[model samples]
Structure formats: structure tokens, C-alpha cells
Target chain A: MFRTISNPWISLASRLILAAVFIYASIDKIAHPDLFAEVVHNYRILPIATENLFAMALPWIELGTGVLLLLGLLTRSAALLSAFMLIVFIAAIGAGLWRGIDITCGCFTVSSEGRQLGWLTLLEDVALLLPSFQLLLTAHPGISLDRRYLPASPLSAEPR
Target chain B: MKDWVAAHRGKATIAGAVLIVCVFGSIGLLRNAVAEHPLAWVAKPPVLVKYDRAVRPSPDALQTVTLEDAAGMAFDAGALFVDARTAEEYAAGHIQGAVNLPTNHYDDELPAVAARLEGMTLIVYCDGGACEASLQVARRLLKSGYAPVVVFTGGWPEWQGAGYPTEAGGTPSP
Candidate 1:
């Protein structure tokens, strides 16, 4: 499982998949900042004032990292950030559940994904995390812009 | 954990952290420049109860009213129980004698639910556990002239899960 998935082609596929997800997830949020802000407020996690800020910014962060991952440029950075973000997402949802705060918006996602316990449990969280962790760990993910632009060295090139 | 971090260790992890900070930080800066707003870590809305009731929030009914409190007032003719879940969720099952008035549909539900709740302590609730509908509905009720409403934040699922009386079907039985 590990070797098959870690191959350049598989790693590239994983990176693109994670990228597409983050990109797709961020679109509606960026378009509807107000609704997103209200959703954030509903979690009751952040102060009333900061809700708008997160609403304003999180989608962009997702978009930026997602684009980088999709292009196989900054693959490691993008995937690492993606993994960290998922960890935060899981924690936020978990904390909301623990505190009994009612994080749902309507169907799925608190901030764009996995707002409900059922949604989180039904692979939304883990499915997203798997590729990101793969991207973070796999060296020299293929079809990478980094490989082209940064030139050869184990640090920036094919593994020795 | 250490092993995992060590495997990914290199400039990539450092760069990722920096990029994330820079991007998120830019958001913060832009927000401050274009729009200024207060930032609180998290804010808890108060649970408002009627004046005749003890001014002190019953330990039972802070941001969330306990299941026991919900049951204690379940059948009180004078206490209005409002379910903030979707009509479908209410139909699936809910606290017996609780009226469906989902927060999202507040405007549509207000006139009728409000009329029924006149002069009574309103208990706003939903399916519970991070379900904001209860809080949102409760606040809306407060905004819509219902004062001192209690958020049964423990909500419908909790009430039902505890083996309390429940009712189901298209029409809520309040």
C-alpha cells in the first residue's frame, strides 16, 4: 500500500486530488463571505468580531495552498499546510462536539467541510487527510513544477 | 509523532509554515485595513430567562439548559418549547409537545410560533451537540420581542436520547 501509493504517479495523483478538493471547497466560501462568517459565528468558537476575519481569509489560504499543490509546485509546503489545516479542522469540529456547540450549517461542513459529526465521521475528514499526509511525506512527488524550477539536488530533485 | 515529523523535515515544512502564516497574516492585515472589527477568541451568548424566574442563570440553564431542565418543563402549558431543527428532522422525531421552528425558517415560523408562546417562557432547542440552530433561534426569538427565553441547548436529540417523551411525523405536536 505504501510503495504503490508513494510512486511518483500515485503521489502526483494524490496531490492533484487534494488540490482540487481544497480549491472546490474554497470557492463558495470566498463568494459568500457573509454567510460563511455567520456559519463561523454559529460554532461559537471565535469571538463575534473575529468571525468576519476568518471568513475573509481562510478561503484564500485554502486557494493558495491548493493551487500550489495542484501545479505540483511547492508540493511539500502545500500538502504540509493542508495536513495542518485538517488537523485544525478535526480539532475544531471535535471541540465543538465536546462542548456541545452545534457546528452544523445545513447539510455538510462547518467552514466548507465536515460541520456535522456524521459528515466528519463518514470519511470527509480522513479522506481529505490521507492525501495531504502522503504529499507531506513522499519525496519528489512527480510532474512537479518545483522539480522543473528549482533544479536538481536531493533537496530539490529526484531522491538519491 | 517525532518520527513522522522527522520524515517530512526539510525546508518544505518550514516553507509551508511560513507561507501559511504569510497568507493568513495578509488576510488579517487586509481586514484591518479595509474593515476594522473586534477580535475575541470566542464569545458565549447569555441564556436569558424570564424575570419571574431567578435572575441567576440556573446552573442547569447556562448557554445550554440541561436535559433534566428540558424535561422538568416539558409539559408546562405555560412554557413554550421550540424546536430549531429542520422540518424533516422534527418529523423524524423530537421532544413530545415541542413545536418546530427552525432558526433558518424563523421569519416563516415566527408569527404562528410567537403567537402560541405569548407571555410564556420560550425554550429554544435543536438536535444538540454543536448545533447552532438552538442558539440562533433563541437569539432570533429574543430579537423578535420574546424576552428572557431559555436556550434548551441540550436540544431535541439529548431530550430523546435520555428516554424522555418524543413525538414524530410531519406535524409537530406542541
Candidate 2:
């Protein structure tokens, strides 16, 4: 079970999938901080003062995490952060659903006309958690920048 | 714990990711600083309530009123309080005498209430703290030719908290 789970191919697939998700999610948000800030405000979870700062900072975090994951540098930590972010997203969406507040998800796009917050969004976040956990648990350094920097070990000594 | 950390190469990996995050975060902040309109760090609800008995704000401008303004408007003869909350929320509890014109259903609902809104000042509000429905509805009202539309930023929660008049159970028919 451990060998199958730790397969280099599985690690690579998980890393690539998460990288695409995060990068695609970050673009529009990075372009329009104002719209993103409004979306963040609608959540009503964070304090008013922190909303703008959070809006400004979050997309960059996503972009950086995505780029790092794509390169497979700091793969385990990037996956760890991805897992953390997914949990936060699930919690925020859960809170919004509980409040029955009519709001856009602001997951992919910050536009007012974007996807409405719903149970499906909660499911999507939970689904993304699978790959994040996979990478976190077994990040293979082979075929990644980590191959050179990370100390060679059983994870890196792939039988090619 | 130490072995677990070693197996995952946690120390260096965590450090690298943190460094990347910090660098990118600083870049984002700097970019926002130089942008055309930097977002407000702290939200301060407008003090339109203070305008009452003082100089009325320009008719053309969208005014954000405080709870006091909404309460005062509740009794004012020409002023009409409009609730932008959902019908369910409106039915649950709302400011006394406020008409429901929920922002979500603005298009479908506006026509039903248009005749009643003619020649009246509209004071719009929602659930309060961080709720945007009031502002949205107020904008729609202004566009629909309702002049002197004021947003009660401190909305139902503030009004109810202040021991102001309230109504519940059944939303009045349009």
C-alpha cells in the first residue's frame, strides 16, 4: 500500500494537478485586487481592516505556491500549504452556507456573476484535498528540481 | 517527530516555501500601493445620520446613513425605508415599515414596487456589518430615478440592537 501510494508517477501527477489548479485560480485575482477585495468582504469572515490586505496577499501566495509546485521545488511544503488553504476554503464556504448569505464563491473568479456559493463548491474543495495530501505524504524528488537540492534517498533513487 | 520531519525534508522545504510566500506577498503589497486606487485598509461606515438636521447631502450622491439616520427616516413623512434583505430575512424581522426590494430580486421585484416608490426618499439597508445588499439596492434605486437614496450601513442589527422599532412575521404585499 505504501509503495503504491508513494509511486513517483502518483507524486508527479498530484503535483501537476495542484499546480494547474492554483495557477489558474490565481490569475484573475492577481489582475483585479479591487474585485477580489469586494469578494473577500462579502465573505464577512475576516475583519474589515484585514480584507484588503488579505485580498492583495492571497493571490500572490497562490501564484507562488503554484509555481513552486510546478517546479517540484519544496514539493512537500507546497503541498502542505495547499492542504492548509483547501481546508480554509472548505471552512469559509461552510460558514457562508450556514449563514445562507447570497454570495459568489470567488473561487475561480472574483466577478459578481461568477459561480454562486453552494454545496458543490464545498465538494470541489474537498476533492482537491486528495492530491494535496498525496503530495504532502509522499513527494518524490525524482524528475524535479528537488532532485538536485534535496538529499538523495529512497524517494529520489527511482528505479528507471 | 524528528524522523517524520527528516523523511519529508520538512525543514528546508518549509523554509523555501515561506521565503517564496514572503517575497510574493511583499510584491503584491507594493503593487497595490502604487496602483491607481489603493483599497481602504479599514472600512469606516459613512456618517450620513449626522447630516440630518444639518446640511442634507447632495441629491445626486449616494449617501451611507447610520442607524440614527435610518431611525429618523422611519418617522419622516416623505422618507421610505427599503429593506434589501431576502424575503425570508425580511419576513423574519426588519426595520419598521421598510418595504422589501431585495437586491437579489431587484429586476423582478422593482416593477411591483415602482408605483409606491414614486416621489419618495428611499433609505436602503440589509443585515448590517459587511452586508453589501443595501449599497447594491440603493444603487439600483438611484438608477431607477429615485433621488436622495440613502444606505443605512448600520442596518437591521444596529436598529434592533438600539431598541428601535421593528416588525416581523409577514412581509407586506407589494
Docking class of 2: acceptable
DockQ of each: 0.26, 0.31
Model 1 lDDT, residue A150, Cα = 49
Tell me, what's the RMSD of every candidate? 7.3, 7.2
Whole-model lDDT values for every prediction = 0.67, 0.78
Candidate 1 docking class:
acceptable
What would the per-residue lDDT of candidate 1 be over residues B1-174, giving only the tens digit for each residue? 435444655764666567775876576446545543433333345444433365645532334467777677766767778888878788898777778887655676777766677888778887676666777677667657675577776676677778887778877664
What TM-score fits each model? Answer: 0.60, 0.66
**Residue B30 deviation, candidate 1, in Å?**
3.9
Quote the B-chain TM-score, candidate 2.
0.65
Clashing pairs in 2: none
Looking at model 2 chain B, which ten-residue stretch has the lowest summed lDDT?
B44-53
Candidate 1 chain B worst ten-residue window by lDDT: B35-44
Q: Report the C-alpha lDDT of model 1 over A1-160, residue by residue, as the tens digit.
A: 7666678887888888888888887777665554466677766678675666676677778878778888777666677788887787777676667776544542133332334554455347667898887776666688888789744433332453
